[model samples]
Target: MAYKITSQCISCKLCLSVCPTGAIKVVDGNHWIDSELCTNCDGSIHTVPQCKAGCPTADGCVKQPSDYWEGWFANYNRVLAKLTNKQDYWENWRNTYSQKFSEKLQKHQGQVPA
Candidate 1:
């Protein structure tokens, strides 16, 4: 199974560099995981999925949930576009971007994506 990056992400590129499958990517100025290319580090040298191991947030990177689907990408894109400005988004990242992203996803999808 593949892993996912959640709104808890702080834009740190740690996950990007550690993913053995190169599944992590920057999309519309935010990090994303390409499930097709993800390996969950099952066969890789790392005992754990590197992305999760490297991520700083408590739950920023995690195994993809059953509810995750294609439509969520559009929701993610729409939400990210509104939250991508560094000055406005990152200055208070922990409380601002992550919280707003969760609130927006709950509003748009009727639940948080992750």
Candidate 2:
């Protein structure tokens, strides 16, 4: 199995430095885990890989989209939505992305935001 990184990655550079084989590299000016070099040494190189590990400053240093979504569903997201009263707005926002995957993504993101 190959290791991976997600869009949520904060480009922390932790994974890259922790890699033993230097398989990981930067793409589009962002650090990405290179599967070829992952080594499955998942934890041998560094303690917890340092990406998003216990650092308050890092939001999603290492992310799995499915897991992240599940965790979001678990947390007080529903309550937060009710408090914000922006639920319907976000629903419409999601509908806007109901297009073909790449097209919808392109339409939604004209430029990457920090």
Candidate 3:
């Protein structure tokens, strides 16, 4: 399976330059991996996935099926809060975003469009 960029990405764009297939793209304020083009760095220039290696965040790039987007976002926010000394700000944002996400999930009955 291809690797996916989590919400932990931070939109640093470091992965873009490292990706051999040009699969990573910035969309809607986040950096996303194009699954079709992603090769998990297999049979490419790198032995390890470049995105994962290039990413500064813990678990920023991970195997798709195993990476839960919501959890990743929460973890990312937590780490960001600590790093930036903005715990309160990040916590507030996380709470608001989580609430909105939950509401949307409920409205969709847990079926999110891929």
> TM-score, each model?
0.57, 0.39, 0.56
Q: What's the distance in Å from true for residue 8, model 3?
A: 1.3
Q: Pick the candidate with the highest lDDT.
A: 3
Q: What is the C-alpha RMSD of each candidate to the true structure, in Å?
A: 15.6, 14.4, 14.0
Backbone clash pairs for candidate 3 read none
Model 2: per-residue Cα lDDT at residue 57: 41
lDDT at 26, model 3:
89
Off by over 4 Å in 2: 42-114
User: TM-score of the candidate numbered 2?
Assistant: 0.39
lDDT of 1 by residue, 1-114 (tens): 678888889998988888888999998879999999998998889998999988989668877755667547756865677678455567687788788998888798866466
Of 1 and 2, the candidate ahead on TM-score is 1
What TM-score does candidate 3 reach? 0.56
In candidate 3, position 29 carries an lDDT of: 77
What does candidate 3's lDDT look like per residue over 1-114, in tens digits? 788887667888899999999999987878888999998999986889999988899777876764588658866876776768864786898999999999998989867776
Ranking by TM-score: 1, 3, 2
Better of 1 and 3 by lDDT: 3
Q: List the residue pairs that clash in candidate 2.
A: none
Error of 2 at 80 (Å): 16
